[model samples]
Target: MGLSPSKRVDAALRRAPAFAAACDDAFDRCLADAQGAFRGVRLYQLADAAARLHASLRASVPLVRRWVPSPPPRARVDAALRAAGLEGEAELSRAQLGEFAAELFREAVLAGAAGIVGVGVAARAAPAVVGRVVAVYAAGAAAALYLSLG
Candidate 1:
């Protein structure tokens, strides 16, 4: 095997600090879920963790945005949030957020810097959603993609 999931996470930590910090915080926030994502190395478990973490982040969006300097434009934020497929205030399941995040990352890449920067706020405001398990998810598969590449 090239590397275990834990090893991959260590590599990611070395590769990105903000990402790593978000991972670290996520670990502290939800130990079982974090373990599920980091140690289990199962996509299902990882996806579960991503959903919970996203929920945490979703719940705390307003608080996190306050800390971010000049948050992304409302239009872009709304557009991205819309991708989550929420009907009013209905909560999303892990699968739903994961699907949305995966697609969002790909679309963001095509959108260029603006799209990338739009999602960057998640990094600075990662916590309060608890260790940001998504970062620790691989530092989180879909959550990591959502935060890093969203």
Candidate 2:
């Protein structure tokens, strides 16, 4: 039998925390690399770095949600996006923001999984297990970042 929508969402939330953690780790690595590659950069360069980071996080958010399936509270999602630097004068509805957050989570999960596999760690594990593990880690990272910032 197919899972109920709420049940599926609940399953996804369980994975969210891990995905969040993986995402944070990925961001930390990316920032470190960027800094190393561009030492003593100007203010504009720093701004550019910040922009890239924001874009990366935004893109990853949807992936993590898709892979891990965390149906966060609408208010939480909105607050997260805002904290992550998504800005607009217009009011965003809960549904819209929720969808965005879900998508972002999925994206992050996929990216995290890919990263793990790319580094040759996934070869030792079954594909399904690897995917699930990656989802959990990424979701956790994302949740930590969200809670800390939001």
Candidate 3:
């Protein structure tokens, strides 16, 4: 059998450093693209995504805080959000944070798929990948519910 729900989350947390690095690289690329596109609107969107992702990571994987010695990448992302004019207001609630985590999971899956497929992964493929990733999270949540109800 596969790992339990909590185990899955634990495994994911163990992988957080690598994931965070990949996310930062992706976010930087997106920011560059955004800056070139619409006078930084795209950059702001990316910054928001980065912030939401950071917050979700913080919530889901508390071990991450101890893993890093210096200012973490997520903190830098949050700083970027403030610099982008999204300060003093939490842009994402709990539900939104969950959604952002799902999205990040999806992006990681898609990136891996693209590497395996050896082809260009289109932006349109994101939603489908995200759906699949969210389904995994849903299953884990369901398992937690079953355990709690037991």
RMSD over all Cα atoms, model 3: 13.5
lDDT of 1 by residue, 2-22 (tens): 554333433433354343343
lDDT of 3 by residue, 12-118 (tens): 64466654554554455554655644322242354456554445454544433322222224555454444434444433333333334434443332232223222
Each candidate's root-mean-square deviation in Å?
16.1, 14.0, 13.5
Clashes of each: 7, 42, 0
Off by over 4 Å in 2: 1-11, 14-91, 117-150
Q: C-alpha displacement of 67 in model 1, angstroms?
A: 24
CA lDDT, every prediction?
0.38, 0.43, 0.43
Tens digits of per-residue lDDT for model 2, 46-80:
23333343344445444333343333334444444
Scanning candidate 1 in windows of ten residues, the lowest lDDT window is: 62-71
What residue pairs clash in candidate 1, if any at all?
A: 25-131, 26-131, 26-132, 134-139, 135-139, 136-139, 137-140
